[model samples]
Target: MNESLLGALRRAVGEPHVLTGDDCAPFLTDWRKVVTGRAAAVVRPGTTGQVRDVVRACLEHGTPIVPQGGNTGQVAGATPDQSGRAIVLQLGRMNRIRAIDAENDTLVAEAGCVLQAVQEAARAAGRLFPLSLGAEGTCLIGGNLATNAGGTQVLRYGNARELTLGLEVVTAEGEVWNGLRALRKDNTGYDLRDLYIGSEGTLGVITAATLKLFPLPAAQRTAFAATASIEQAVALLARARSMLGAELTGFELMSAVALELVPKHFPDQRLPLPAAPWFVLLETSDAEGESRASERFDALLSAALEAGEINDAAVAQTMAQSKAFWHLRESITLAVAAEGKCAKHDISIPTSRMAAFVTTTDRLLQERFAGVRSATFGHLGDGNLHYNILQPKGQDARSFAATQQDLSLLVHDRVRDHGGSISAEQGIGGLRTADLQRYEDPVKIALLRRIKQALDPRGLMNPGKVLPWQTMP
Candidate 1:
């Protein structure tokens, strides 16, 4: 640890808020428990101005800064490299609900506010902030905006980028760039906010945001069903949309292996299905209240049944029942973790090619790695699928992870073949940076590098993220 950097950080944001020694353990590891890195200190600033000053000092000292929100990101976007010269700019202390406009249906919140906290505040004010995700309890709004996060409600309310009206950011040069204008439409200049949203903090430190909100959904409905295959789930989703239209809010698909592991890990939240090839969880929301929502939902399920899309199904009879249905879908994370060793590939393809993609990947893994247990599931409506594979019984976890590169290539190449993306909701962090260079086109990669150079000339903002320093020949 550099004594000079520590002194600078202390002078900028007080000495007590700067974490050193063993106190920095919690901020060192990412949420997935995959990658762990070291940092000189964790700087917890209480306000946006303090963040600007801290960044400026780090820039002057030629030190790296890892801007962190809730540190709930699945990827190690917030984790620094082995070099302990970097500082973890912890935004958790800057939490505040800046303002809530009931009439405009917009919420101004600091970056450190928990996602669920933002939602609760909106609900209390008789409005809705629809950027819903499984990590709502811990994921911070800043990280969501930083990654342009897509959640279950993306099909209805769009991702965090769309829902966000403005931003307050600290640039790499330690300048406070305030772009917070809460307007519904602005055709003046480039959509600069988009550049920072999914850039994974490489571009800047997102301090706060003005997020758009929506009317409270008066009616809500949920359904869980068994599908013969991924094809059947896709068919049912289209059918539901034809009937429910924009009211369709969430549609998640689950695999038997993924669901099976859920009961194994979270015995309390098990689904009744013993063995099924595939499962689908669909939900709908409307502004008419929960009354008659079940009837409409049941009708949709019946229609899907007669259409031969669903082999078996269940509709929630009440709000409590609806919550339980979602609980089952959200349990996929725990389920995968319980399955021993697994590799996660966050990929997306055109909805039309999903069945073919799933079938091919499953067959390929079985042939290449004997005894490998694979589970394919996630938001089918949006075409983003979590095609994760559990390692074969005899293989060591480390050995299997070494083959992660080969596995990711096999999966991502197929996705690219099908006009899909290797990364969907998950942003490009340290682990994915190498693959981003490997798969991304030359022109696109070059443009990304230019953007990085333009904003972060010194490459000190969030080092070792987004794009790789080297590329394949």
Candidate 2:
């Protein structure tokens, strides 16, 4: 960038907030370290006004801007390009919980407020913010919205898009759109809020948001159930949902390989039925009381056990035990990361066909690619699965990585064959840009481009993230 542009950026956000060279190194690489890039500078804007000013300055300089929050994204959605022409617009300084309306069950949180912090704030207000993920401690609500993140509790509370009531965004043209209404219903002509939610920052920068909240559950029960097969796990899920109804908050499935990694990686971790072919970490919650919740959980599991759907079961006796049960589920990602380099697929299929997809995909991987290990697990209640494959033991990491694209194609092609999405939760960052073009419908792709062009004509807002510059034929 020219000196004049640098000076303008420095003026927009103070000199101390404008980071350059080594100061920008950390933000250049993504959380997974899969995507790395170079940035002209990293700008820390303290407020929404400052964010707008920074955007205006970048636009004036004809420099692209990549908006980032928390930087805990699985895909490289927030990373800049290798050209080093983009400025990293880091929102950590805007971390603030603006307001908590207890009566309305709503809270206004800034873009950089940690997701766990928002949850705690809601809890302090005697409410619940239902978005729960493994990286909640550091992931920001802004990036969650940008990717339309879906976590374990999505079955109960819906994804990030549904949790949001309104958004405050800084458009690509450097205009602030304050659509931060806390109302539950409005017959608005056009719902622009939905446009930016999963746009992956390619549309505009999300600054703050009015989020929906719910009454905190009065009682909760978590249980780890073992099944003979994935099909049995699906049957157990149906039984739990049918019996527990709204009280069922989570239904997660993990293959034996996934469970084995926890103890292998996290030494302190332990599971009662680690050798089970498949395990479902399920939970039930009620507003009535703990006694009633416990009774329901036990009754449902007993029925499942009697029906032979579950081979074994363990219910959390205390809060600590409940957390431990959840820890087993949450630790899968970290454990897998510790294991070795693997190709990951966050895809979804019909709830009924999940077992068949897994069976078929596992067989295909074994038949086509010899000696690869698959660790499969995810939010079974919502039909999303994280199917990851580790390279054969003693295999060269570089040689194995060279086959990533081919391996991904094999899994994604099966996902398409089974009428599933290539991406269930994680958005198409620079990593899956080509996949989006290949798998997404041409008509939908065209519409997406039109919307992108309409909102970001100059294509300066996180260029080359979600949508490609040219429409796919």
Candidate 3:
């Protein structure tokens, strides 16, 4: 950038806040480290007004802005392009829990606030923020909202979009839209809050959000079980949902290969059940006491075993044990990461078609690529599965990379055949732009383009991230 633009940025957000060269190195790469980018400069604005000023200065200079939060995104969405001309607008400095209304069951949090911080704040106020995920410790609420993130509790609570009540957004042109209403019912006009929540920062910068909270559950129970197959796991989820009702908070499915990987990578973690073709980690929460929840869990598992829905079961005896069971579920990703490079698909289908999708995809991978390894696991209740395939044994890195595009096409085609989404929770970042274009409807794509043009006329807001690159006429 020119010296004049740097001067303007320094004036907007102080000289200390404007980072350059080595100071901006840490923010250049994404969390996964797969895609690295170069930025002209990194700007950290401390307040909403500062964000507006920075946006205005960037507009005046005609510099592209990449709005980034904690940078824990799986896709390279937060990273800048290779051009090294865009300004990296980091939001970490704006962290704050603005308000908490316990009676109203709502809390206002700034975009840069870590997700776990928001959860803890809600807990301090005798409420629950219900959006739980693996990167809750480092991921920011802004990125979560931008991605419409879904976690284990999504089956009961919902995704980030559902938990959000309103937003305070800074437009691409430096205009701040204060739509942070905490009201439950507002049918006044078009719902603009939903538009920016999952737009992945293409539309605007989400400064803060008014989020919904729930009464904290008095008691919770976690259980681990082994099932005969993926089909049995699906059946058990259906039965558990019917029997447990609102108490059924989570129901995760894991293949035997996933289970084995956990112990192989993390020696401290132990499997709760014997070796089986499939496993499930489930949890139930209620306002009632532990005894009641325990009895319900035991009865449900016994009934499932008798009905052949599950082969074996183990209910967590204590809180520590419960966390240990959850640890096994959480460690699957890290274990897979330890193994090697793999092609991962975060796709979802109808809950009923999950079993079929798994069976079909497994067969195709084995037949087409001999000796390849597969690990399929995710929230069975919501139908979102993280299906990953590792390179076949002794395969060269170059050869494995060559199969990614073809494998992605095969996985996405099967998902489409089952009326499933290629991206269930993760947003369409730079990684999946081409896949999105290939799968998404042309009419929908055209409408998205029109909206993009209307909101970001200059195409300066996180260009080439969410939407595929297109010349706006």
Candidate 4:
């Protein structure tokens, strides 16, 4: 039966595109290398019709399908299971900017299109896609939508779910739903597009998207500021929002420990300011000229310093300098990874309670597990923090990693107490299915399972994802 199904898949999307053995290895592991899985074959489909055909073949043979894009997700959502009975659907060949309507401020891009490519396409058309992330260069737009990604600019522009106007999906029944409408005001029923955006391929395969665009800002300014504490950093965020208003595009908070790792791992990257307990990297996109943008940034930072909200600040003088500031912010993840095994949490809490939550959680972890270090940072503007707990110095890395479950439970329990979410920007992929079951309301989980059953009745669409398989009735 497996061989017959593989033959059908090869027929649907040519034999050359059907990958097996060593060629399938690359698509099996996730970005973080935390989990690896097996597959019968990796099927590359170049068009929506081909995707439909592949799905039809898989469904007919009762084979599970794991739809994968660039495979850049932090969670192993795109990775298949150990069953080896599934076919990994690779979408890289379908990459293409189908259309760009500058007047309507929308662009249609296939699921396989690299995120950076879509951004470049929008820029060439005198528009902005506004979905900037560290993985934009290699991550696919489909995966971004699959996860409903939130990046530095989410404070102003919003997440991928808000930026997407429509989607072109191939459903579990091996049928294409062309709901790619560009209208802004559609009194539609059910909102099926939204249902699939963050569903993480459990419902259907996202083949392409109709994405919203924004006008390119006239001038942009960036700054890196030092703060005495998380409280100070939060205060500065409030001040920036009040003063800059809509112009404030990004506000990222980084711990001194997080920043310290960059210099230790990459000697070339210099810290712009003296180390402090906390730091902020912020930016503003002004409709006015460069002079006006610079004036606004300078005024904002100076007021922050004088008001004692921040210790010191450095405004980027040029675009290169601005990129450098962002580079430092982006490098935190790599630095943390270099240190060794760590317990990571991507969570969001009410901005009002963020400071208290961090302080309390940090103290509790210290009390519970001695010498565990916190290397935390993230989009403070949107209230999402990558609160990561690193293994203690001189401790056995594996031993420290063994306590990850307990560490995360304490942190997530605190998040629950503070009115926060366990999974923030990152979707609850396979890695967090158990976490979802633990923290999420039983009613919500049941409803999600119903939706999955209604759409993929055979339970073959990316099984063991978003919704846990064990608890499914």
Error of 4 at 163 (Å): 0.4
- Once model 3 is optimally superposed onto the true structure by TM-score, how far is the C-alpha of residue 459 displaced, in angstroms? 0.3
User: Which one is best on lDDT?
Assistant: 4
Instruction: Assess the local accuracy of residue 139 in candidate 2 as a C-alpha lDDT between 0 and 100.
Output: 94
Local accuracy of candidate 1 as per-residue lDDT tens digits, 1-473: 77887888898899999999799999999988888889889999999889988998888788889989878777788898887888999999888999999998889999999999999999999999998888889999999998889988877888888899999988988888888888989887888888899988898999999999888888888778998988889899898889889989999989888777776788787685546789988889876766566667888889888988988887777778878878777778867877667888888888999999988887887777667777777888999898888888888888887877777778888888888998889888877887787788889998888888888999887887887655211
TM-score sort, best first = 4, 2, 3, 1
RMSD of each candidate relative to the true structure: 1.8, 1.2, 1.2, 1.0
TM-score of each: 0.97, 0.98, 0.98, 0.99
Whole-model lDDT, model 3: 0.90
Can you tell me which runs of candidate 1 are displaced by over 4 Å? Answer: 471-473
Clashing pairs in 4: none
> What are the lDDT scores of the predictions, listed in order?
0.85, 0.91, 0.90, 0.92
In order of listing, the candidates' clash counts read: 3, 0, 0, 0
Score residue 318 of candidate 4 by CA lDDT. 86
For residues 73-138, write the lDDT of model 4, one tens digit per residue: 888999999989999999999999999999999999999999999999999999999999988888
Identify the runs in model 2 with alpha carbons over 4 angstroms from their true place: 469-473
**Candidate 4 weakest lDDT stretch, 10 residues:** 464-473
